[model samples]
Target chain A: MYLFRNYLLVFNILIFFQVSIFANNRDSILVIGKVSNNPQKHYSYLKPMLNYAVSHMKDLGIKKGKVLMARDNNQMIQYLQEGKIDWITESIFSALIYQQTTNAELLVRKWKKHSPNYYTIFISKKGNDINQLTDLKGRKIVLEDPGSSTAFYVPLMEMINAGLTLEFLHSVEKKPSGNNVGYIFANSEINIATWVFKGLVDAGAYNNEDWKKVDHTPVVFRKKLNIFHKSDTLPRSIEVVRNDLPDPIKKRLKSILLNIENDPSARNVLFAYQKTKKFDEINEDINNELNRARIVLNKVHENLNSL
Target chain B: MTMIIQCLKKINKLIFLILIPSLVQANSDLKPLLEVLKENETISSEQFEKIVDAVDNNDKNNLGIPAQINTKKNDEKELLIKIDNGLKISTYDGSANFSVGGRMMIDTAYYSDDKQPIGDGTEFRRARIEFNGKMYEVWSYQLDVEFGGGSADAKEVFLSYDGFTNKRIKIGQNKAPFSLEELTSSKHTTFMENALPNVFAIGRRVGILYESYQENWTFAAGFFGESFDNDVSKEGDESWGLSGRTTFTPVSEDTKVLHFGASLNYFDQEDNSEVRFRSRPESHVTDTRYLDTGKIKDVEKQYSYGLEFAAVLGPFSFQTEYINTHLERKIGGADDLDFFGYYMYGSWFITGESRAYKSKSGKFDRVKPLNEFGAIELALRYSMVDLTNGSVTGGETDQYTFGLNWYIKPNIKIMGNYVRVDNDINADEDGGVIGDDDPNIWQMRFQLDF
Candidate 1:
């Protein structure tokens, strides 16, 4: 009788486990959305992480998972406004835009590229007499493409705030006017450092993370460059969700992301997700941060449009 | 805090409205306006509760899913073809990929005269066709069949799931997670034939395996049944086994690696069981088995374990493994026997190409040629297997091999090997052939796969 009872108990547990694991209604699903120009690469990184998260959320009204890719911030903002997306992982600049245009709020801050925060640093070759933002008058400087936050917006904002006028130079050989600082797009950080090192440009600016990377700042260039200025730090990246998403789902997602680093098994998935280190909760201070980002984004947008 | 403050402000307005209805209790417009913006409006709150709940739910679903990555029509989804080591097709969404490939190895050899004649001739060593694919992003499968010996043999037919963070679970016919060289694909092995100790290796079987790995280590364990070719008719239970393997790499990269691993297999016999151990002189083209244990009956179980170490430094790399097998008889007296085998080899690539190591699977992968002509490698190996124990002499042999491999392409190569075999007096193949007979063997192979 004892063995029979034990077998019956085991059989019942197996049935319960099977039913819980495989039973899924079509009504409920978790959608992780991203604003990306490169959908194929982003999908590779998002699919595995979504599958893992959904596996643990099966009982919490999430039976399936899907990825939604938007081509730009405008498309993603429209996605959130239309309720087409449930969650978004984006940079602080994009997150601020989404917050203003839709009923979305910050859920967590992601340590993207293993950095919790990033700021721009203005650099010039050592002994070039370019000691400060004021020294770039009548000289050429290189910044990454217009889409970049660190190399373009932060650096541009700092120069404009310092009362220096910038000129758009189509060629690196072109010099600025007597009262202007000339700037050109290098297309990449490597080129930014190279053009400045070759004396084609007087100065270069990019994120501190790239400044330390060998691929972006070669060892040979690091010895020749001097950092003259550093911009204000901003949250590296953020994960936002619908403001009125059910509390249970929000709670579960927050818990999962916060503990992703605690489990050694998640190391591979985390590394693949843009080399994310960990997630920190977004407190009420996010309000002030977004407000400031709003001002900086507008100024950068206005300045770039004029150029 | 923001939501609370906003809710409080609305509550204050509701309070004023409650007073206003009293102040203007006779006004009809005020009555409807108060009811329009309702949340617990001076009743027991049952009726207002339902209305508020409905409004909240309507606001909650304000955002609904529209089009997504999988929104394209089935026929409109873009498919991309890639040609690398193999030809592969993948969807633009990165959700699915498939590849069709095969490998062929043709061999020829000559055996020196010994006490017994060992026949040598040209033959096809391996002719394989493989179909592998991944679907739904996390699910993958491989189906491979070998038609080398004028017959079809199932090899590595399995469906695998990699949905977990860094782990994988596979089911169906696959390898039993034992032996580093056994886990390495045959097309990538340096020599024309495996070292003699492969006699202790469990090549492939029907099994379910769970494997996980990181940047520096790999862990695999599985339970297995008999091979697909084991067509035995038995009234009693069939044989089964458990296998596990773990590998650690202090340094892991494509050109540089320091790897150490160990594996074990525990197999149980059926009610009526027998076992045999035999091996050739490390050359597949020869049809002579100078070492044989014949057959032992009343075997209860078998236990085997192996230790492996491998390293690659730039153009030079080396690998070594030692395996031991212990057998238990049903009589349970002093009849238990132990046998062992070990092999070590080293290779140098003269054309600046390095051996590739895959940390995820804890195995060596295909080597690519650096030069247009090809990468040439010279290698040497020493291997020995002893199957002799008290009252049961299988045989003992030592073999030395020299190899030259030319990798013309990533998936194409030619190999030449020379081997010298030395046997003990007990290496008589159960007295079917002369003992203490030494032989020299020469072999070459042309191989390609895609």
Candidate 2:
């Protein structure tokens, strides 16, 4: 009986020590990333930018910037809720989700790859009879990964608004029942193009930027395919900070990033960071759009969960 | 006999009436049996006709047995091969994607008024097949081989690690980081071939390179050994070099850009290194080089520095580069030789399309047409090279060129260039003192990539 009590006391002490360490380390800036399609590939581009941002914040007791890659959206939400991640850069869809679940606030809009905004474009083979969204019934559509806003959610919401029933399939080869449009996840923009071009799917959807990229949709394929529809534009990407972060650090980070372009020494660092053009302050119109996006995200979540 | 015939007819009628219903229910197989019965005189002609009519009616009414349906299982595994844009094959799990592509360029030139005969003929500029892909999403590789100009060559066979932020480490045969023109892909260059300064650009070499970039700038440096497929070195000697380039863009946008860059190259020559610099009259098909720097002997080390500036404002873009090369001799009391060259060019798009600037390499990329018809571009350039310094007179030359390019598609283009060359009075072009001979050349190329 005495030995058991001693063991319990030792365990309690260890737990207390771990809690203290974690509490002290909470002040360190933690950059969180969700593995969208390719974890390693995405992290490779994010790490340098995170390092540069953290290095500029050394005056705020930010000695280092650490990256924590979440396996999925759910895990990312859990991390935000637990206050484990202090900052995040994500797509509009993910930003909406975090805004609803964890109260993350938008800090700035990142001009990723020099593109400030992008819109979804629905494409089909030139001779396929699918000319409009209504004609997609009973046909299969390929989409980029679920995390992509323009490729997945924007088009999906539009389709839902059109009163078309959608059924998710495990692969592109699966057929849908009559009166329902089948959709499959391609996990990449190029794969979506391939699916539509090779007649594996009746239609495909992605951003206009990808459609124009020669590498993604080569000229040979573009000759045989045509865009049938396009969605409204949305902000490309944004940087967000946890709402509970200290206000001083927030202002300082914003100041540092917004003025990074003006500094000649930071040129190479900024160029390496995914060719980031510059960070701009979020405006009221963007805020309203984000709110609307939140509603769309909620509806999408309900539909997917029910399915 | 009449009574017997009447009895047989009656028997046939009764048999036909009984078998007609079965024939109607049976498939096409029963029709053969009915024909046999009629042939053997077991049934009358009218009875046989009635059976055939019933079978045809049943088939139309879907009452016949499903005509020996040939059902196939369709068990063939779908080969995940895709040829929509480019040829690509991928795994179902999205872990691997591979693509095969190639490009070809056919060039022809006609030169006039050359005192020292310049060959005017047609030649294949580049015919290359390239294979590139990413493995496990973090490692990427490219293997390119060229078969043109009556010879086969290897180009850009390298593996790269892109798992770093805005940075990549490449190891293999690749262009040493030195000049913007040399780094930019050949398919995207503004002219058919680079200017005279390209002779000192330190082309592709076997090397290990590191590259990183930010929004408006890029920095690349590498340590390189002798070029791939170079001649075997003598015993106890080998060639090696180091080169680096940095570029900064003050203004970089889709339609506007201002770029500035600098590069440095240093190399140690092997024993008996005979280095020479020469160029033709802005044409690749001509065998005669008007500006020839004869072999410089007793060389130990060579270094080159270059300055570059480029600006793009909508349909108008301008670019200029100045390069200087110096050689340090190994023998004492032998004066070192110095050479310098510069070129400036400007281009305008008749269709109002701007030159596409690739920020990754700080160079120009493919020009995309805004309209359906296509885009047309016009360019003019002035280049000069001086190789006569400190008694090693390799001669000097100046050239002016005008170019026209029609981009019919992203992968297909037709280009035409008219060049005028003037060499110095003491130029020794063909191993002899051939006095200043002016030449006017016209070149054209049909290029395609996939």
Candidate 3:
């Protein structure tokens, strides 16, 4: 009688734990929003594309994909990993690094203005005699954020190859320009570029796509700033899904995306974005390119360590 | 004629089935009937399908016997027996194996000063329970605890990685490397516990450890700071230390085995708390070397150096070690006190058998097994500790111990020993006249380690 009672007690406890785990796995939809750093300058250009993607979420069987307006990549990656967002459209470089530590995947690539290659340009403020990379030594440059691909990786890599390393010229009080010969995160590219134009920083770096959208180009920057260097063409932004999504659901999502431009049902969605052409298959060919980028990025990291 | 023959075969099978059971029961087989059944043709495909369906649905009578069923049952029985653990539903098979081992000791003593009995004469110092086995090729673990200590405390609870290199990376607390005497397992130590010098010199430090062994050489090192006993508060006070020791046996299958090792240790304490050496000194005569003096203060700076050697020949084995320690304290400006301790101890098996030290195992193999009864051993050790510059007491001492051991079985032992202590005494009250400053004393102990 005692043995029978013990067996029943153990069975009840195990069932309770099993049910608890099952309850924790209940699924829910994630919503995300995106915004340009200079909303007045670039929001008009991005609004249509953002709205179109949201409308097509149901055809993609997402049922309820919500749009949130975050102005930076850090918040996007954080929310995406925490399941607050199911998919993210970010630059290839940012996607490459975030995927290393999270279960996110590259779902689609953005055909920016229908061009696959976008390079970052380094600019200096007006009245600053920094015309070349070497002259920027002992001068402060502003990078939008730590995870920015064109704003951070490109300019940093270019400076390293030219032997102009990241270093401090003098004490803060002795700095030729308050921001000269140092690097600081401006939170947004517009703020970073404005800092350079207003003489708050010596120079600044950002991607060509964002620069093309800037209306005024800061008359001060046009007067003093010079494009010291430009990085190699970087792949455009890609929409990444979670890595552990069910295979069947993933297949359906992929089919819907690859057929988006061809299907009349997805026409309104595709029409919202001007530069988008059509969904393309992502396979070993694209993976090799990403691998090459990773190697280059790792080398740049190693270079930073030596400096 | 063909039809008649087919019918005859069917009738023969029915008759044979009826007669064979009776024949088997009678212990007298009918050859013709058995041959008739054996000569029957295979069943038609349609008939075979029906039989298979019946069997699947649990409707078949199963009159026909299976020859291999008995053989399979016997194999399973053999497997269960091998894994049976005591009376529990346990077994020693490919899935699991149990190791029965322990470390038991006895410390007997005598002192030159009758005023102090530095050694704890109570024997049976330790009895440990050790279990190490495996579930499959990739997963293995060990659970070992000391029973006779103050409480049954866990010593080693670790899972090992055995698939890759010749060495194993153990991901749990085991032993720290500091002193050769400390590293030498208590089960095979010359004395019950380490000497008075060792107690102050080395104590158990726990942390993640990695060890590798190949042929005659064994190498181990670790990063130790946080221990299971004190996990929470030990974080910020991060005083991490590392130790490594290597032992080599040059010749293969030699009666006289040799073991040698060296170790280094350092501790960096945090904030106001300083790292220090913890030593318990033994007073032989009155067992109170310094009642007049206050308790010893914990020091700040700590460092240890050690070397050891052991050899086995025929029925006798010898072990020796030398350790030098330097203590760093704050009260006095950079007062670095260094002292050295060494002892040469040996044991002889009174029984005819010789001591076999297993290289693969960091332990001595079944020792002194008698032909029928049991085995006996006699051992002697002498050690001196100089505390003149001890940085704590400012005293000097020496200890002498003689011991005898009896092995009742491979896993059991009975031990007895007598130790003497001699130390400098400042004063004494004897008939209004002060006796000799240095007094003499004696001590004895008995213990069992399984």
Candidate 4:
């Protein structure tokens, strides 16, 4: 009777172990993203690329991959904290937020939309007196959405560092008084250009790529505006993996992404994946820049708390 | 001093009761109001300082109106409407999407004097409205209607399942998998009309098709019956066909592409078995078809095949196609008939724009201008068709055409073409025999698509 009981206990343990192993293999890797309002469109472009990467990692025990999109950064943080998302690709600012909030580790730099990096440009009408960031006191300026790094955070950080007192205005037309630069969020790059060109705002700030694009700034508008200042270049986007992910899977994913350009079979999938040019290891310079951005973000938080 | 202290305490209690709500309501700093109270002698200096500290602490702890928690669930699905270069409407969550777009082609042509009467006039070559959308994330559908050719016609109306990677299955009326020129959208074609080889290409039909594509290649095959609104046979007999096409790109890039493709079609005719092949002189407004196979009678089966080759090098491109069709007669002792045609064309963009290539479909897409004024394209083509096979006397003809196109925008263009036609003595137009009459034609079209 004692021998039979021990045998049954061993058998049950084996079954449980097998079941757990199967469950892990079912969705071994999860690629997560923040859901754009257009989840289906986003999924359509994202699924194939992730599938390509997952297929290449089958030897690494990644049998399958799944994609999950959070509605916002807060939800994304929740998912990351729960270990539901093992890998991620997002803008640098969002990556920083996720890094600070969930301890996600940056894996590599991504050349999203075929651009490796972009810089913010401060613009005003050609005849305007605001040729530099210091002259923007007591005037209205427009920036892109608050979530945008190049258009919002980078430009705002530049102004703050230039010793200009800044106030977020409820509207673009509301002017602030006495050495304070009033700014409003335009929510779109084209809107920023239009607001500055039409004199609705005294100046505007956005990425230099948008400033050079004809669709955002037409030839006529281009002639009317002048880029007086440009911020330091920042990485276009980055890839991250949860710190708790298995070392082998993380290594395999990084290897696959970094070598996708060398694999001709992944060409179409890569092109469809937001027209990504390639992936490369994040250099020390970029890492240092990210650290600097973290400091700026921390300072901003401290200032807000002091208020 | 005791009386003053008592009065100040009473006033401070009243002020706290009144100003606390104001402070919460205003969402402002407490220092300014506290200073004002001290200046007005409403409170002592020590009381003012204490109250200021308490208010600041309360504000820091968010003891205000609970900071609008944004508890409002964002359950209302947002509908996104955008009008940039095109018009598109989609659900914010992307579970469902829809787009309404259309295209118009206005054509005019003038023909030189010919032995047979040929009409020269203006006509609406193609005017179509299309609705495309996705449902359930995996299903997509398109419905297109044409009002050109002076009548309403249904074009592509199909629903597709795109659940698999690099593959899709479609059902309903759609173009049969065939030649490259026949598959490319008319709005993006180099010429206003397709070339002679298109005569043998199976056009649109009601069908079910399966398609799969890789990075540099595509394969499409389908089984099709008569097109929508096709005339019903007397005994409800329907013709059916099986067709397939495959294309491979040995080298494909943004500015360069080399393509090779082939297609095969087998069609089973109805009991009557009557098929006709005809083409105009590279112009839409002209009604006379100098090259006509008239009618092949008692056709049991028809088999057609096409070969396509195309290449794009920077600002220049070359395209050519050859197609042949064989007919089997039902009557005994009747020899089988064969018809063949081919066309070659070359185009150069004066403003330096390469024709966009869609690798998934193995076809050329719209041309986008690099400049504000737009891009210019110059092209020349030579085509020949021979319908003179055993026991068939469908005259032979050759045509040379020169074209000029102005792309004002990605979706709008103006085009002009000059064609010179050469016909053999056996050629006939409008059921009249023409003794080797050659004609020159001039055609123009204004087109728009969104």
Per prediction, the TM-score for chain B is: 0.82, 0.80, 0.68, 0.84
Ranking by TM-score: 4, 1, 2, 3
Q: Once superposed on the true structure, which residue ranges of model 1 sit more than 4 Å away at CA?
A: A1-27, A33-48, A51-63, A67-259, A263-276, A280-307, B1-97, B112-117, B134-140, B161-163, B234-236, B332-334, B369-374
lDDT of 1 by residue, B82-189 (tens): 676577776645567788899999999998867778887998899999999888877989999999888998888999996776688999899898898888998999
Tell me the tens digit of each residue's lDDT in model 3 across A96-168. 7557657677776666556665787888765568777777777777776556778777777777777765642
| Candidate 4 local lDDT, B80-153, one digit each (tens) | 67775457777644557788899999999888877766778999899999999988767999999999967889
Name the 10 consecutive residues with the lowest summed lDDT in model 1 chain B. Answer: B60-69
DockQ, cand. 3: 0.01
Off by over 4 Å in 3: A1-307, B1-70, B73-113, B116-124, B147-152, B230-236, B252-254, B271-300, B329-332, B361-368, B425-450
- lDDT of residue A87 for candidate 1: 82
Pick the winner on TM-score between candidates 1 and 2: 1
DockQ, candidate 1, comes to 0.10
Query: lDDT (CA) for every model shown?
Result: 0.80, 0.78, 0.55, 0.81
Q: lDDT: which candidate is best?
A: 4
lDDT of 4 at B36: 84
The weakest ten consecutive residues by lDDT in model 3 chain B span: B60-69
Instruction: For candidate 2, give the docking quality class from DockQ.
Output: incorrect
In angstroms, the error of model 4 at B97 is: 1.2
True lDDT of residue B208, candidate 3? 64
Q: Tell how far residue B220 is off in model 4, in angstroms.
A: 1.7
DockQ of 2: 0.07
